[model samples]
Target: MRISDSMRLDAIVRQQGHLKEQYANASRVAATGAKIGAPGDNPVGAAQSVRLQGALDRIDAFRESIKTPKGDLDQAEGALATAGDLFARAGEIALQGANGSLSATDRASLASEVDALKTQLVDAANTKGQAGYLFGGTSTATAAMDAAGNFLGNAADRTAEIAPGVSAITSVSGALAFSASGGRNVAADLDALRTALISNNPAAIAATVSTLDASRRQILAARTDAGLKSNRLDTADAAHQQTQLSLAAQRHAVSDADPTTAYSNLIALQGAVEQAISVARTSLSTMSINKFG
Candidate 1:
């Protein structure tokens, strides 16, 4: 049962090295406030933190995507409201023109107002939003309606992804909102009313009263659709906000060190390191004495 000085020295050196490594790691955790600086420190927690961060990033992207579409829907809604008001006034003009008692001069003057309303409705149909034309369907770069009351846009619906698997319609179809595609051609109806008033035709003017009402209803329906899309965007954004907050909390739990616990560990490791160095030195001194004697 012989004990060697070299063997004792080697064991002391190994023990000191291990204590120094632990002290270094604790110091980094305390100073940086990160429990998992590298995957080796806590592999499972580091992996979880990565996944949570990816989810947070996706939520942020989805929220950003909602912003432009929501603005487009608001502008579309406002344009439709303006169109509705214009149609209402046109309806009133039609009613007044339908009266047989009105003089020819009076009907001619009412025709002027109908002309103005028709122009305004065209302007509303051609409204541009953040992305492009509001009622142009997917063909948003150009005007939705031309000067002669023809629909310049297609009937396609533009859509955007509001959530992972959820898509929402963001663009309105001018062909449906203002042309015969929905029920009647709104601009043509205005033209008929104006023509009836100018020619002093009692029966034609009376017919426009019903046509104008139908056009107004079409605009109202389009407006309702825009409002519903806006509500869906709001709901999706709220969900994204909640998800981002939850993901952040989870990431913090896995990645961040508790300040108090980190500092306490650092202090404890520092003491252990100092004690290990002292023991190493004492062991080396005793070995030197034994060898020299």
Candidate 2:
């Protein structure tokens, strides 16, 4: 029960050190405007913050993925629309050419237009999307056209993840679209039209027209499919955004400290530390007077 002078001094020093540490901690919190400076302060909150940040980054990446592909699919849809219109026009010309009442000069003039439409259709099929070829699938390093108007694109599958484990297929492979049901391509039909016009064969022109009609239908069907996928992507994106917002809210509630409350508590801590220092100094003075004065 007997306390030595050295023990008394040591106890006073330890108390002062503890008070100083509290003051320093409060000041740091005030300056940094954060209640959780280190993991030791709030281990659970710190861990949750880390997880929330990871989720936010992933959601941002998912958003970017869907955005870029959406634009590319829209472009593909536009190109298909234009190509279909041209094919319909070529069909009209084919019907006109079959009429014997038309003179050779009329056939020549109509053939020129048919050739121009063919070229235009080629340009449309070779359209590029945001990342690569719209109708060329995943590979888009080069133009997707050959001398015979055949598409030389790959058949790669691509999808976008909208949620933690849910992903939607937003893109169609070029091979699937061009090959259609029976491995037929829009360009193949256009080539037939080109041959029919250049050869001035009425029967050939008619056959090409039929094929072109089918090609147009095929393009339309593909476009419809792309549109549906786009819609689904948009829905998924919205849902993902909502989930991200919820995560952010949860993180803020669990980990983020209120500046106003933190500041008030810090001020109180500073006063308490100052009071403890004053009392410790008074005790030291009393000890000095009893021992020496």
Q: Write model 1 residue lDDT over 146-195, tens digit each, in one string.
A: 87778888899888888877788877777888989999999999999999
Q: lDDT for each of the candidates?
A: 0.89, 0.76
Best by lDDT: 1
Over 1-293, each residue of candidate 2 has an lDDT whose tens digit, in order, gives 99777887899888878877887877777777666789999998889888998998888888878888788778877877887788788778888877767776777788888778878877876788777767666668766666556777777757767667887776755665565432567777766766666677777877777777787777777778778877877887897799889988887776667788778878888787788778878877777557774
List TM-scores for all candidates, in order. 0.91, 0.82
What is the model-wide C-alpha lDDT for candidate 2?
Answer: 0.76
How far residue 36's Cα lies from its native spot in candidate 1, in Å, is: 2.1
Worst 10 residues of 1 by lDDT: 284-293
Cα lDDT of model 1 overall?
0.89
